[model samples]
Target: MHGLVLAALAVLVSLTAAASLNAATIGKANSTNCVMLIGGEIVQGDFEKFVTIGKLLLPGDDGESTRRNTVCLASSGGSLSEGVKFAKYFYDNGIGTVIDDGQECYSACAIMFMMGTATGAEVSFANRKLHVGGKLGFHRPYLRISPGESIDSSAMQIAYDAAFSSALDLIAVANSKSPWSSQPMMKSDLVQRMLQHVGNDMFMIDTVDKVGRWDIEVFGSSEPSLLSEEQAFYACENSLQWQNGLTKGDITYSNVSDGPNGKRRSQSLSKETRQAVYQVEGLASGYAMESCVISRKKGTIFGCGIDEYSDARLGQGDCDHSNFADRSSSLKAISVFNPATKLEDLRTGQAVVAVQSGAARCFVIKGSQITDNEPCLVIHVGDAKVRGRASTITHFVWPSGSKTVLVQSGTSFEINGVSTGKRTVAERGDCYLNSATLNDFCVLTSPN
Candidate 1:
């Protein structure tokens, strides 16, 4: 019996090698602490090799080792069975995954990418990540047969059954809570869409809606950006909805307080100060009355408020600062809004604000002059004292975390006393500080 099982395994390995002409190359990522599975088709041989190396490189059962070691996937996909095996191994080990910018993970590769998990300090979360420029495509699993190969009805049925069984396994893994994170790997709708595409067709997760719905973390996109009047207003409204824990798709916005067809108001303020009193519906029981005060010159949200009708009223009877400070959803909305104005175009003294919630009346500039006191959180762009040096600085206020400052002039800015050149995009965990003031400038890329 042992000899027969060994023989069966040998035959299976031989068949897999013969079928997978272009096997994936698995090795350490260059200049980084990550494992890269690049090119070709995923096969049993490659999967086994990865497991062997992964076990040695990722030996810590405490989850920290797995979190530090990410498997970056860039493949056109190969064997569905092998892909399933890889996914199971990643989930069991609490390994994180990344589809980096300019990379593509399709078909079986997408399956492996979706199943990546990691354990955080307090809770476990889906560590499956997709860069903004990366492409992740999916299609239904199908049996592959050599050209002109003759097969009986029984053999064909068995092959079909195996393919279907693999699909079912994929669904189960997607829906099942991670042993470490206790979070579903992917959304049900994402799986449904994945299976909808047959054979050569592909369902690409290419939009913000799909990305958000699937619970995939996206990075490397432009940030601390500016938005149009319409997009900014929508973001403000969306932030309110998120703070109240309302479903994003359920809420709808209207420019006018009455309805969609209501008459537009002639502005009492200058063109540089845009004001809008919008109505937000699809809340609990009733709708919300909201107002937006924007600085058109700076392309920032100057002030915003939710009225008495808002469900997010935290005893203050209006836009509560606690709600905005409690959640970082608003910062995410700011970063995701498209057709954003460039940061370089912005002038000095112009404030780039994130999300603001307060009880003060929304500011509306009158006739090119400031009328009301600024009620929102503001980060000015000008000369400031940093570590005993007077430098021209621009600061960004994250939702519930520390600030990120951009030094424009004065002293040479060095992260950890090492000059990182003119353009430096800080990583998530990096921290820069002015010892004189103890101001921590940490780069937190992810909104969560």
Candidate 2:
């Protein structure tokens, strides 16, 4: 990003003009590009700073052509919607930006740092550690355990939220839904934009490519988006950790929270333990996972004494424990069915030697962002909506680390950009999104 230096203390010096006074000016040396030295933990407030500084340098679409803006991210991530607003500014202005890896662009920073892509920029990294994981970051969509029976009057604040949320929303929402944006966002689209959303208003969420399918959404690694049966089963069945192993298919469910209740629950609902239950008996979970649904009233079947149903039975609420009840009803359980049994039990952040039993699976929670150097299969329960560097998705699809199933139907070919087995009921081949081999390429599958 240019070896030139621009200290905040420096910008506080050079940008002494009148019109730029109200603006949070950044420093630009010989590079002509603006450099913002981001420090301290990331906050939604910093995003406004990004916008103000960017506007100061590049002006707006209404003004002369916007100059490019580059951010030197060296802090932890904060706020999802805020980051998006900041990034949206760069994106709309056709500005390019970069994130030096040595400077930590932990959470929302990494996503917004991509604003450079608005002008065909790159999500460049410096030469340091890049921690990528989970989207329920410190910014946007704030939450707090309401005081006893006080869910409505819970002590919450939308302090660091940004003002550009409205304008950003109009553009992002349309772009997300636009067909020319390339891939249409399915209702099941797996785009995690909390980093790009606005307001700490969690309920005000956005959905792109609503034409396709989606399986689930997670607030983070440990919770579902809400308590609807749809939300419950969002990604339940897609959680497969192994091709074969003792724990591979040993499905377990626990602590199912009964709707807006939060009195305190300590139990889960799932099927009995069997040798083949969670195994790759025939290289399939046998059949592709249908949008299964479970229920205390409908789906509870007696198998090995415990009741269980297909992965579609995601939101089958059974836990009636008083502890799970809500007072003001604002603090409610988001998941009626938890797809994870022992996902938290695995040692993931460890540096260990490799083995190929494939028993452990990445924590399967929707909307929970995942970034890695190795391969991973991001299974969207219904219709899978995916994006990012192919490595982020391709590796997560099939075991080969090369094969991925994008938007599989019960049978038959879906559309262009997608290729199926030419059968009515066979699994899809590979689906690619602008697949360009060496660095880019995706195996695409969609409905025709």
TM-score of each: 0.56, 0.27
Q: 136-251, model 2: which lDDT tens digit per residue?
A: 12123332122363321111112112223433452363244212244222121123443244333221111111100221122212232112222223222232211011123423
- Model 2 is weakest, by summed lDDT over 10 consecutive residues, at 12-21
Candidate 2 wrong stretches, greater than 4 Å:
1-34, 42-48, 55-68, 120-141, 144-180, 184-448
Best-performing candidate as measured by TM-score: 1
Cα RMSD, model 1: 14.6
RMSD of each: 14.6, 21.6
Write the residue-wise lDDT of candidate 1 on 98-177 in tens digits.
88767888888888888887765555656787777788888766556557755555555555666677667777777778
Superposition TM-score, candidate 2 onto the true structure:
0.27
Distance from true location, Cα of 151 in model 2, Å: 8.8
| Best candidate (score: lDDT) | 1
